[model samples]
Target: MQAVHTAATAPAPRFALRSSELPIGVVAEQLGLTLRAIRHYEEMGLIACGRGPKNVRTLGQSARARLAAIADLKALGLPISEIADLLGPDGACPDRLKARLRAQLEALDARRSAIAGYLSGL
Candidate 1:
């Protein structure tokens, strides 16, 4: 079966895989991730993949969405732990996600201001 694209409202950018399963190399390429990074994320349990023929790691639709969310959240400065909580078994709570994101934005704002101030003094 061909993999279906995850809904836009599914919480993150979801790319499609030609088939129900895709090799690690293809996933890494499409997601702009490295094979090692993909493996690392798997090791961290941030996402899960399955074993395909020849034992190559294969990522399915759900797994792709999860990895995409992990990458997007990480880019936004969310740690893996927070991401796990956000995507936990109960699924995402809008309130919780908003609060955490708000905090991260505030922290980033402070850091940017500090850097600007430091640069001005130079």
Candidate 2:
């Protein structure tokens, strides 16, 4: 007797692996960060990347967003640790992250006022 395989029992289709085609160096350049800085962020658990067949790091859109956020937070003087806390697994910005950013901005404003006052006294 011959066995019959049903169409409903067919295996699922495989997806093409398009995510591994991104280049790490190009991402770094686009984000205005050094390749070493990108690796450092990965080491700090701030960004994630996939390994290519040859063991090269392949960053995706999420990594690009994280890099952009890191650069923005650094510009705002939030420090690396705080920026890492604000960024999520997929680079989604949480609402509470704004509180920390606001606090940092207040501190920067106070510092700027103090510098201005000192300059006026000279």
Candidate 3:
């Protein structure tokens, strides 16, 4: 026998998240982070949230997207401080990022030269 599913019999989501919002747990799951990490991001002023029922933090979709970018930048080795500057309203991040890349390359070249000098002395 083929079982028919009814709307009333459907399982509800764990939270009553609205279309525009995502609960903090879900947001953290999406970003592959722990609740503590999500809260740290908020404390770092990199993202903002709203208080839901019982004062649980709820983040909107935009905030979630921003957090995703924060994750990506952090993965790319940018400290939270640098990520904040790149995400700031006044930031020209593409150009700023190019400059940062060039600086990193120069630093790496200097490190390489120092390593070569050390090896020559050995």
What's the C-alpha lDDT at position 53 in model 3?
Answer: 69
Clashing residue pairs for model 3: none
Model 1 lDDT on a 0 to 1 scale: 0.79
Off by over 4 Å in 1: 1-18, 90-94, 113-122
Write model 2 residue lDDT over 2-78, tens digit each, in one string.
76768997665453236434777778787788889889988998888776646778787767777888888887777
lDDT of 1 by residue, 9-73 (tens): 45642444347888989888988888998998889777788887667899988888778777888
Q: What are the lDDT scores of the predictions, listed in order?
A: 0.79, 0.77, 0.81
Structural similarity to truth (TM-score) of each candidate: 0.66, 0.72, 0.63
In terms of lDDT, the best-performing candidate is 3
- Per-prediction RMSD in angstroms? 11.4, 8.4, 5.9
